[model samples]
Target: MKSSYTVENPDYQLSPKTGMTRSHYIELAKYLLEGAFQHIDSFDDILTFPLIDGKTYPQEDSPAWRFRSLEFEALERTFTLAAPLIHNDPETEIKGINLRDYYANLLYKALTPGNPNSLPMPEDLPDSTYQYTCEFGGLFKTLLLMPDTIWSVYTEEQKAAMVKTISAWGHHRTTQNNWRIFNITTLSFLKKQGYEIDDGLLLNHLQWVVSYHSGDGWYLEQTYNYYSISLFIVYTTIWNRGFGDEYYPEISKTIEKSAQKLMESIGNFFGRDGYINMWSRSICYRTWVSGAFPVAFMLENPNLLDGGWARRLCSGSLLQFVTKEEFFVNGIPSLGFYGQKDYMVQSYSCPASPFLMFLPFICLALPEDSPFWTETENDGFWEDLGDASTQTLLPSPGLMLVNHGKTGTSEIIPGKVYYDDPNYSKLTFNTHFPWEDQNPDGGTSMEYAFRSLDPRDLRGDDINFYLTGKTVDNDSELRAKFTHSQNMLFNGQRDGVLYRQAIMRQPPNNGVGYIIDLAEITLPGGVLRVDRTRLAFEYELTLGHFGLPHIDGVEATVEERKLADRTVMIARIPGRSLAFITYHGWDQAEAMTHDGNNAEADSSTVLFARKTAPKVNPKMEILITAMLHKMDDSEWTEEELSPVKDFTIQTFAPSGSPCGVQVNLSSGASHHVDYQNIDGLRTC
Candidate 1:
């Protein structure tokens, strides 16, 4: 874990939140780049390393194989190290390699037609357009951001050859996602260089991608992940600073407004401690979770980080990952998020996958006197809101984030459903406790499981989760042309409580769709879950509390307290405690232990509550309150567990079924939920 380069002195005055400064960033860049630099024998060698699992793609060397693209990931991502270093100080060197000279030589070698590491053209691999064009943005952005370092040093012939390779990706069929930005950025760079491209096509793509701006702040992607900030907003801001106004000013206006709005609330998503609400995929790009900070600082006025907040985030985000010895395997950042967690790894990820995270270092390209550097860091909302949580509802993507004041962690409630993986499908994702991987029983933290009708096994997303989903903002028509397996019927916040109403059709039994409403109100320790279940038939249901990372072999104590009205299940270790109270429905409680599945620890204990039956009523209310805490409080108070001092149910039927309901919590929070319009809910 010893770094080859180290930040010498601490700057607590400049950065109170994280103690990271300009020097820290430089040394950190050198430290990270050293991993790749050590493995590089010369500029001609491809930038890649062994996958942590030591597995190979099933289609290696075939046209479908993404091996070439994986190699490109290595080359373009490592450029992030040299990009700012060479620009900020051209004499930069790491591990005896002249950073500027090496990257300059690399640019030429990788762009020329015959180099081993050179990216394959679109025509060469017609099936995988993502491979042909995905990395060009990283390549061109470095050139554009600091021309003197790499691009300016190149000979005219070297530049021309690179352009030929760049220009060869004129336009082609691909997933209707971020590639629009990639294509547009490439075209904009070419046009800036006085090369000819289809202006109409560029404008068309420009207008098309602008529609992806979710009015609240996010630019939606297929996965609806962190790329919204790191890739979508970053590339959009870059293009706008370069060519947006000249090409299509009207669309540029809309883009600017969304970007500005994004800057306003983007930082709120990050905890006071600076950990981003890590709710979605590609967690391998660890620190890039806050990758939007650099772009916000790079932008002009209305980019809105109150006072030198970007540096606080940048520094904290970098430390959150790099400081962890487990974050690196051998030397490079691991292919997984926190450590070498197999659950977080996807087939597409490689050792270089984490390299894409280097985008945050682009802050190094900024001038010293810029506000991002000179001003003292401040904790924006954490300083303002004392002991309270902030629940920001983003309707465009059905994402609701609750920033806890005491825990210094963020919990996200997402509306979209991805049955294939808990990464996206989980009802809740906590910053401190991330999603558990490779859970065979489907009883993962912050997720649900239903016993199979066959009674042979536990069933999860594979049987019931949506194959794909998206919000309406993702499509240009105000509604997309294609159909998604699932959709967000409604996403809204009522009185500090974030709620998402969604319906899922059993994939095997398409006619057997069910409506479920997920709602939660924040607590000092954890948020309380109030779920409305409406199934056509009775099914055994199980819910899990946030998985507590088992620490230092300390055995957790499990106890069940049965009060007059409800039973609370408590499990606690020294530093942390996890409790589950099944308030409304009938249930049994237990704990599941896991190993090698969590990124934060070697093993974890996830407490679960099960509803064996609920009187055979199709209309049932299930209230399971769970709290996972880090002793911000000395001990669990009796009053804290019962946040809901009162719950008033209305509209009782003679058949003993409640037609509608209302909730009044002891914390002075309330919610009015009704099934009156449940059938009328909209779907994408």
Candidate 2:
């Protein structure tokens, strides 16, 4: 990868640890765009070019049209960094294309009234290209932020055309959620350029965006992931920065406060190793999460994070992805996070889509003298913080994050998630392992369900289960209650909760049926899942629990014991261990190996326990306690393992208690259940 311009500015300083400077980031942005546009003959080719090798993302009514946004993404960052610096330096051409001419050609093709290759303006009824509203937002934002370079380079005729195009898009109807930010951003830019803008339209969308804010610096965008920090918070901060306090004064304050809140909660998501959480969607837009840090720096708000920490975070996250061979293929970003894995690629992804990862370089738009470039970089949260156990409850997203700093492991127990998407609805998301997609028997931290199928047919439909609802009680500080339910049929009869049927290979005389209600309570390392099952017909039931990744070189061990009323299974690696204790409704425990269960690792293993009776009682409630912990690697007495060895769960009410079980720890601390008043339950 070669940069068009050399780093000649003395003000641009490199961070000692990350080896990243403002020039290096700018060079990266330029390199990515140059690679993307290398073969393009005209600006129109951006929409029609086939950048991806293996797959062709046609521009029909398919979801692939959204990939065109990638070109705009690359241009947005390239121009954002180039516009401010080009006027000061004469040799500013990137890959033989002058900044001014390149942007003008793009703008002319996108906004020219009768040009054959011009972009489609807003239409009353959205077509295949309607999703480009976000791209338009990016375009307008680039023009607004770099007015001297973008606006000054355009002829009066071209400026009129651009304004006309933006006016139509500003008033155009868009999706009510995050898409509303498109219109808000576009109109804000138009107003800055002296266009007569409708305040009502701006305020409506502005208020609509504000409505999605879920306090403590989080916003609900399809269930809160990186977008809460990257897009929502960054957009509002840009709005406030573009149109100072003179307009929407109160809203400016709200944006600042939200940015501050996000800053406070941001450290928990980034690992000490600088890897961002891989739990959510758009994993290819890798370093965009660092966009929030730049916003905090631009706002001069130390409360969000200091310059040194921001540099460390932004540079660390950028390097974490860029330094990997799997991140880029043929100098273009691949679809997967670390490699080309089809499981992580969503329907809307295209080859150019990964360039959106350049969003963090928006910080490069800041001047060289800004603290972001000049500050002495510090070791990020991972290195600065000591060994500690930290748990934070984010109410807006209904997520409880437990960070075991010493072991460099973190677990997120999500309280509310979109039912249709299992990525967010899993029992727990661990930072060390990527969630398995479409594999019910794999990647799940804990799965509780009834498997009624032939022993030989592992592919048989094993109706999966998920966390339906969760609530935290006002009285309980450490305890949160959750409800799990699944809908199935019984004897060909449709019922919401009961499933009664004969196994496919079994005789009609051996038919079985059951009605099940499940719930869970959180613990330090794992969750205690309680399933109350009522046998409508006699059949076999099995429950499985998967522990953390067991790498190839690591020493792995599994142990099982059968007590009078419970079956216990424990799996241990070097510094961590997982124990599954089934108190009732289980007869035997066994160890199982899973092939191709991990995205990063080669193979994995799990522990499963089956209830004792082939003919279970008509109505039975089962309690299974799962404990995951980072074991103390330091040599110590037997007393050290006592807490884990002596862990016990006492069920108070099989199906009703708010706190479903009284969990006794080896440390002599006991957790009581009170199921009546639960907290944190919000309808998705």
Using TM-score, give the best candidate's number.
Answer: 1
Stretches of candidate 1 exceeding 4 Å from the true structure: 1-7, 42-45, 54-67, 170-172, 246-248, 418-420, 438-442, 454-491, 495-497, 502-504, 507-513, 552-555, 614-619, 631-633, 651-659, 682-684
lDDT of 2 by residue, 1-684 (tens): 542223334332456666667767766656656665565666344433354544324345544324435454445544444554454453466557666667667766666656654555656335433645776776566555555665776777777877777788677778766788778888888787777999898999989888888887888887767777777887678777777355788988887888887777676776555566667777777677877777777673744575776777787777666666656665566777766666666756666566667667667667778777788776556564466556666655666676766556666656555443545544566665555443343223344434333221122222221132333222221111111223211121011111121121222212233334344444444445544554443345555565445565453587766554455677776665666776655666667666545555445556666653344234454544454445544432233223333333444546564224455655455544333222122123
Predicted candidate 1 versus true structure: per-residue lDDT over 1-684, tens digit per residue: 384333467888888767778888888888888777667676556566764544423244435336666667777888887788888888888766687777777667767889766767767764655655667866766655666777678778778888888888756554576777778878888888788888888888877787787767677687577778777777777677767677667776777777777786787677677775556777777677566777776666634875467778777767777777767786888777777766666676667778877788878877887777888998777787776777777777677777877677777777755444566767778777777763546445666554323211122223322344322222223121211123344555655556565444435553334555666767765777767776554455667777766675555677788876677778777666766876776457778787776667788888877665434444565554555566442566687667767665555523344544466777776766444434444332
The per-residue C-alpha lDDT of model 1 at residue 648 equals 54
**Local distance difference test, each candidate:** 0.67, 0.57
Model 1 lDDT, residue 289, Cα: 52
TM-score of 1: 0.88
lDDT of 2 at 653: 47
- Name the weakest run of 10 consecutive residues (lDDT summed) in model 2: 492-501
| CA displacement after TM-score superposition, residue 542 of candidate 1 (Å) | 0.3
